[model samples]
Target: MSSARNSYDVVVVGGGHNGLVAAAYLAGAGLSTLVLERLARPGGADLVSPLPGAVVTDLGLDLPRGSRNPACGDLASDLVRAVGPTLLQPLPLERDVRAQVDPDTWRDFVSTPLGVTLEARYADDAERGRVAAEALTGTFASLHDESLAANRGLLYRLLGGTASTRGVAELLTQAAAGAGAELVTSAGVSSIRGGDDGAEVSWHDGMSQHTVGARFVLSNVAPWVLQILMGGDEDPATKPEGAQLRIDLHLDRLPRLRSGADPEAAFAAGIVVGSGYAELASAYDEAAAGRMPSVLPGRLQGRGDTLTYLGTHTPARLFADDPQGAKDLAVARALATIDTQLAEPIADRVVHLEARTPQDIEHDLAMPGGHRFHGDLEWPWAPNRARLDTPAQQWGVQTDVGSVLVCGSGSRRGGGISGLGGHSAAHAVLASR
Candidate 1:
């Protein structure tokens, strides 16, 4: 272990896409910015593996090619055009195939390429309306039969959008280099103490503890970790009011579908696999118990033999301090759902089945709720305010932090590979100077 201390005008923790983006802009502005990451490499969760045959297997969703939000999409396009080819390439949207097994008879499976399959299980329009409401709100609430039926249009529109995957690290690296940011990997921040003059950051590697003084500190790690790093359980300055939980499952075998069906198409198409709110609630509870929940319809995409399953698990309470057990349960439930949904047994076919529990996500990326999105965008939450520049804080490269500004997914219009958090954070940092 080596102990060394370095100085910088600004220091960003965690090397996920958002952090890299922040570093890029700060460096571009000649702010002497430094990015610190705990991973051996700097991609964070977006890291890719070098498989045989000049191919790369992404542990998470493939690199995003476009954005779902129109405004974010336009901004991403501008960033790509300005950054050039090294950052990203256009990849066609791929698809996934999904199927469901009768719980009473596990061997009998009904499979389809359409991402979501609806059953005639709803009793009335109120129940249907309830389903629609939850989908739009992204919350776990019960709805009347009429409510479910009334919200079909909104549900279809939300699920029908094209989804893309991209190498977020690559995008940020190019953006950082193009913008002239300095990124440091394998450096873990230990503490941050703010004063009337400026903020002081203490960090450590295998060998020694080092500190850097900055004008401001925008913690990219979850609100809880921020407390821990500061050597306390509470930090009035860094604690967050709300958070969300998410899980990602990487499966081995490609989900089998009916003969002649486009597996990719079937899988890539998004669907609502589970029934109404009751099923969803039960699934979430099962996940909390570490039991695999029933399958919720979701989209799938493949790069080669590997397939990635992306969807939401049952919602549960997420405390900033302790989340590992919940995350493990979430993974178990996800696996169970996959086992129940795939037409054929996938145990043998799984090359690498891993679940990134919310806790694991927090440990890996230092973000709260293990949520990939910076903030929640469900209904009752205004759309324009859904972006990374909310009054509460900014997730992008912009926002007022004096010399210190935020640039992670949690800042403003949060989450995904769109780089809005970074772009906006960068703009804020530049504007401040």
Candidate 2:
């Protein structure tokens, strides 16, 4: 193929949901906008794969709840509502599930042959009072339990959060097309330069290099990746630090419990098995020291024929900067944790297993930190500072970046497949222009 010269009012990079949304809004405003994606398909992590029996399994995050839903109240409710419907589904756990073996700790134990529905509930008054008293003494366990009990409502809200079942990518494609935006896939962005007058974009397909000049450029790629294209003093705030990716394991068969007398009784049920906060802290410490963490916590969900185990991995700085190894270690830890919880051996019953690392997330979906949410709530400055409307100093959705802007999870509002970032970004861009 020969290099094709094209000019558009706006050029959006990455083709992720956010990029597509920005492009759609711009094009809808009658500005000639074009979307460029390196992949053959444009959904990013929201991509889906066909399973047997006409089932489509999403390879990315699960369905996100609606904005009006309690789980999303703290986040962007109205914006999410404007984008689309809330997709929420139950994650079932079965009996004879795996959990940690420590008698003193409930961190990683599988429920017995009976199923346990994990939900957030307030503790009794006596328990609550005792917990409040323990906090004065600085007893960590008591404090943790107390906090958990007091925050049951909040916890429940988070547990009930939603994910996009069909994936954000496909939705974005439709939105772009509806807005009359042109989309080109399998085109890799090599560089983005120039100023507000127009941006010179150089990209390549297998057969040829393609260049375009656009008045505005919106890059949905992670800030770190963007550095490779723009090449200059990079914006540290836009990129994530520490661990950036997460991996989920899918099992072909759900665990079955043998009931001697009641053969008809249901065995396992869906539950979220985690090491809690204390054990998680210990695991993080061990990982920081270049040693394997003994315990890993995970969320368990059942969908028709498969059971999924999802866990967060150690930070990227661990394993001597070996991100892949860190991811593998995280998966190993999660599997081991599951085995311990199960109480019974299951190495032979595992029919299928796959791991996705942070690098894979970045390359495949353009998500920074492999984080499902756009920003981390742990940082003190994170809460008010990082939101859809708030932009970092230099390279951000704001600034003089043009009529183009970011609508992806990487923006201040952060991650998940809610499409709130995209909706908000489009609004911001439209208002500014």
Candidate 3:
């Protein structure tokens, strides 16, 4: 292959929604921008499940105002009121963000495991589990885990408000293209050379390799991944791994629940399949032991002909020696668990089934452990406490390299469907210019 040295004002490493969002805003702001994507198409994890409002006003696009999807949680009306407007806003995950929240509400959410909080609020395990589904979605923690990751995950999920049934990747892809950002598909970035001057990005398109130079680089991949690409050491401590198993099914029709509830209602509320607090805890414990969980804890979102199952407690490559076997066991457990609540085997309704493991996510999307948010979600308010102290800190995105910035789900004010990280990163770069 010949040496290719194209350049742009800004080069974005990943073409997920956040990348596209940053590209859209950057290109719209008159900075020549190019987005290089590894996947055949963009959209990152397909787990956003919500839309961000900043896209409309800031991007100069009159996109959706509210989700066509239903209000996902019953807690907003009942349990949340009991907690005194706790779920009304995003959970204060960082010590600094806590300033906007009532100190009592923050403590209650952070200190108590979601299951314990639910037990104190509701006596019926069935009702409690239904509410608990939000907290447990995409999380691996058990009801007994002291960290209350469920509480934090739930608070973030609730802040989502409403999302598109189809997700936001395509909408963002179109927006970025419309704004004049150059998007290249099937281009996987292999290395990044960043220093005091501008940087050069090297990538391969299977048959040939290419390099592009840029005055600045904005990353939408995991922060650790960005570091490694720039020749930094891989830190096992901060590197993220994921436990969520996302199974998408195309069914002939929605299965009838053993409880005889309307499929539409259950799907709208997001179905809690085959497990409650104790069962979920047991599954988590079993998986943590590096063995297959007997009972899989998963949530279901479906329409008439399709469903998505997001399972917990199934970590990335659970059986390291037999990775494929581990994924198979996880899938079988997910199907069996779904059948537990169904009058008939869910297999009968399936026209097709696609189960994605953490390994697949890592290999395909370049996420460290296929973690949807890049890593464990954390809280940070001040620049002094975060990973970086550059102007990018204003929006919470960080990277050690002065010319490279992060704008992925891992960024602050951030994660999943919201373009807030991208919006902030764009501002930082534009401000520097």
Candidate 4:
């Protein structure tokens, strides 16, 4: 019974979508929960995937089930099985997740570079380029980077199904509030000190510093950010990094393509530009070597007069010297590349251009280098990385501190707009109790 004036059963730091999800569950289960957010509002700017089926059913939420990318098919479902509801309790023995899949498929997927698969699977250059673009999203490597990072990134995106129309953060906020959880915005957490019973969280609300004691702490920040807040060593290499650019266009109308394909259909799938796999590799190399690629690789999407173009391999490091100048260059290059496939220049249709460089995302999200996943994308079945010994570890939310668990994109099943990370962390807490 947490009845102390300044004490709670749980304190969730960072009131993003996942934190809200965790708070909703904890409060729903009769625990005193509090959520602290740095931003004025809880949710980020993007849409979110549907909450896991169990969460939706239990919460009685009216959120619709989003459609999955057919390209992923059964493979995605199989790879995601290891992190299912079983994660709620401690895992006694580590399992070889990769062995669950076919040997040949596993070898090709994990060992072969993504570029090789793109070349072999799709014959048409345009279609192959479109598929290749998905693999490269958020990844700084080329198809040849045998680390399987691109493949891993693509798999994760497909596994997300798709972003739903309604936002998950708002729904989670309502649920948590209804369940007796306190939500506070603009209360940025500064430090977390843990003892045998619980951890004391210190936060500042611009004018005053406040401290609260909690039986357990759930962090919605990346591990590196957590380390810095805990006065740990700063490891620059371990910090998340972003190598992508997002340009939001408020268009008067959709730009017509020279290929005579319907603008609606083409834009719905995404209009990818660059020669082919070879050209994509070149762009990555040029960007890696400190120059914007001559042929900027980008994808354009048009819906109801709004167009969003996402360009890749333009690392945040490139903007260190002049963020404004480099970002302006990226926007111009993205539009120019689209012009190559358009009947008229896309720049002519632009009502307004809002470009978000990697630096911009970092500043907005406080996500280190603005890397969306909080770090390089990781494959689910990594070599000898499975650890399911503890309740938190089984849920993939373990941290250096026993009482603190990561409930953000840094967790095992985190990233993309899914609520699995929060749900798993909440379950871990309940299981321990």
Candidate 5:
């Protein structure tokens, strides 16, 4: 085979959801666009399982988990226009399903006055979290981190919030391809060169190396990868971090909750375990130091054949257990954690169990340290230091490279599967043109 050379109006690197979204917009705008994917297929952390009986699994979580799909602040309107509303299915959480400890057990845990005050604050803030999630409006960029800092508690609600199903990823792939965008998979980009006139991307297509010339290049890789490819000044000092355990399990049926709530009802809601701010802080500290917390901390949500727990990982991933043993232990631990809040062992109904730790995440998704956000998310209020001072940077999608832009999780709006970065980058490029 011969090396290939292609030129496009825009070249997108990384076929993650953001890249696909950007391609769709750019191609729809009548720009000859091409997307290069290092993976066999697109969707990044949206991993479709190969297990015979396994349902689709995601290495990272998508966002805005609400009943209605809002169009503001999230570029949701643009996404709908590009890919159609059918791409997303709203996950309407009917009620909160966080676990509550017995009065006696709770008393033992919160014997101190400080603990009692912290518990009260946590309870009050949980309601605030829910309200903020419900009241999410406008693009996150418009709100700005500084504005939201007035109520610091809303940050997690926004970060943890999202609304969509796996179909969104598939639809984005189809939509981008349908919009006359050329998608090249298994093409690992080696370097990027950008000038005033245009940008050039070089990559190896497994068999041979190839070069792509484009007027503009959109990167969907992590910030560090971007810095390396672009070969610009100072590399980011912030260490990449991720604290998530993605588990895919097939249950015979929803497990009964100890609270006498219907399992389906509980499953439909965002179930919280280990309530209170103290627990959250402790869990973060433990996970930060590479140790599994005494009590698994996070929220649980599931639909149909899939369930995902956020903010929890296996000891094996933390402590360096054998890969297989680690996964098994993690799955076992997850089930045990779930059992703590349920009437019976949810583990009993498990027909199939699969777990992905930070290690699996790093390997499978090529995420540095398996960080879902790509890197540390800076406050929107932080002084503007990027190459461009436009709203794209506020939205967290701007880059130091003039011709190269970002549309990955590392963008300003915070991570998760929301394609705001894609929408932001595409719009910026179109505006510049």
Candidate 6:
């Protein structure tokens, strides 16, 4: 057993984005706070850093197209307060993502069998297929979360929408340090013991075992990780399954689109590929059954001028039905799929290409099952569950354990790259004081 050291007002476990955010706020409020990170850095999984040997400066990419979290405003506001107005800029309200599919096929899918008349603005088959899929799978409803639902007026005022600086963790760490918070990297917590009075955290810093006491303990790890630390049951239901494949492609130049639209304009918009709604649903079902999808659905976006990243959740061809192999193959397959949708050969535009498998994501980001949302996303309004106001249990920050809080993506308001989970956890700790 490690001996307890001097007590602090708060001791945060994990130095990811959420943990750093909480540390900054807690220290700002004059609380003596200390942040312990397992990794050498503090960004957690949300940070988008440049790949080695890559020349591009900006590495942080936007969330998948069509993904909107209501907590975006809150996170942006907090970040602006921590950094400065100049470090952040407003994101556009315009659609950042665009689906690329055969328009004629889409038109036919939506219209009569003879394809007599058009019903939508889409080219042809793609729109009809999407509409049909949406109708069958309730994809629209599934995409929107009721709990973290966005308020249009408030969202409009959030710096007119914003973009994060290159390195989000670095910014937050600097802000927290400025606020007098102590950040100890390469420190892994062994276990934590807390009660109604306070919390004690035991960790190893590679040199020796050290124990610290605090009025409150905030965890920035996945819930399952936390459960293991506290000797609790690791429920299988909470485990998240990630189907998305994250890819980074350094292209010589943007590929010519089949639509014949301006390259700049097309690059600015997001890219989506799939047969339609039915294909997406089927791919999802296959992935859910521990198999790769036959269709290989994907989303593509151009980051900066040189780097174009394409991510696909569905794999058209799996090597032996293995998820890992499928993820490994996704980048090449995604490029090939995009090639079919483009007027030019995309494979030839490649400069440097890198791929991150779901397993890589799980290990690199330290996310369980590689879920960006931390655990399975809970409906904002879970039926029959007591919904607490913001900054409480219902918000997914506060825990049943006394003064033990969660400040990561697993938190209720957490998902995507929004820092709301950390901000909410910090506010809750502050309120208690």
lDDT of candidates 1 onward, in order: 0.46, 0.47, 0.73, 0.75, 0.57, 0.57
For 38-109, candidate 1 gives per-residue lDDT tens digits of: 777776666222111111121122343332332112221322232222122211111111112133211111
Top lDDT hit: 4
Candidate 2 wrongly placed segments (more than 4 Å): 1-5, 47-166, 233-250, 257-270, 319-329, 340-348, 366-396, 399-404
Per-residue lDDT of candidate 2, residues 1-433 (tens digit): 2222378877888787667766766777787877888888886666321111100122122333233233223332232232222211111111111121232112211111000112122234333232222111101122234234212222222322422244556755876877788888888888888664567888898788888887767777765666567765556566563342233444455454322222112222333333444454465567567665677544444444445555433444453477566667677777767665464443444666666654565456555545444333211012223333432212134433554355555553323334434444555545545
What is candidate 5's lDDT per residue for 314-359, written digit by digit as tens? 3223745566665565566566767778888877777887777777
Worst 10 residues of 3 by lDDT: 83-92
Cα error of candidate 2 at position 122, Å: 9.0
Q: TM-scores of all models?
A: 0.61, 0.63, 0.86, 0.89, 0.72, 0.69
What is candidate 3's lDDT per residue for 247-326, written digit by digit as tens?
Answer: 99998889888899998778756776756767777787888888778988887887878898888878875845787787
Model 4: per-residue Cα lDDT at residue 265? 86
Tell me how candidate 2 scores on lDDT: 0.47
Write model 4 residue lDDT over 274-378, tens digit each, in one string.
646667888888988999877788767657798777777888888889988888787777788879999999878989989898889888888778887777765
Highest TM-score: which candidate? 4
Which scores better on lDDT, 2 or 6? 6
Model 6: lDDT equals 0.57
Best-to-worst ranking by lDDT: 4, 3, 5, 6, 2, 1
Q: What CA root-mean-square deviation does each model show from the true structure?
A: 12.0, 12.0, 4.1, 3.4, 10.9, 10.5
lDDT (Cα, tens digit) per residue for candidate 6, span 1-433: 2323478999989988778777887888899999988777778864332111110112222222212222222332432232222211211111110022234532332122211222333375575443333222111111112322112112222322222224667767877888888988888898988886798898898889888899999888888888877777667666665544667777777778898977666565555566464555565567556566666666566655554443434322233257565665566556676676689887788888777665677777667766555655432222343545434554457677866888776775444335656666777787677
> How many clashes does each candidate structure show, in the order listed?
61, 33, 0, 0, 12, 16
Judging by lDDT, tell me the better candidate of 4 and 6.
Answer: 4
Q: Give the candidate order by descending TM-score.
A: 4, 3, 5, 6, 2, 1
Residue-level error in angstroms, candidate 2, position 304 = 2.4
Total clashes, candidate 5? 12
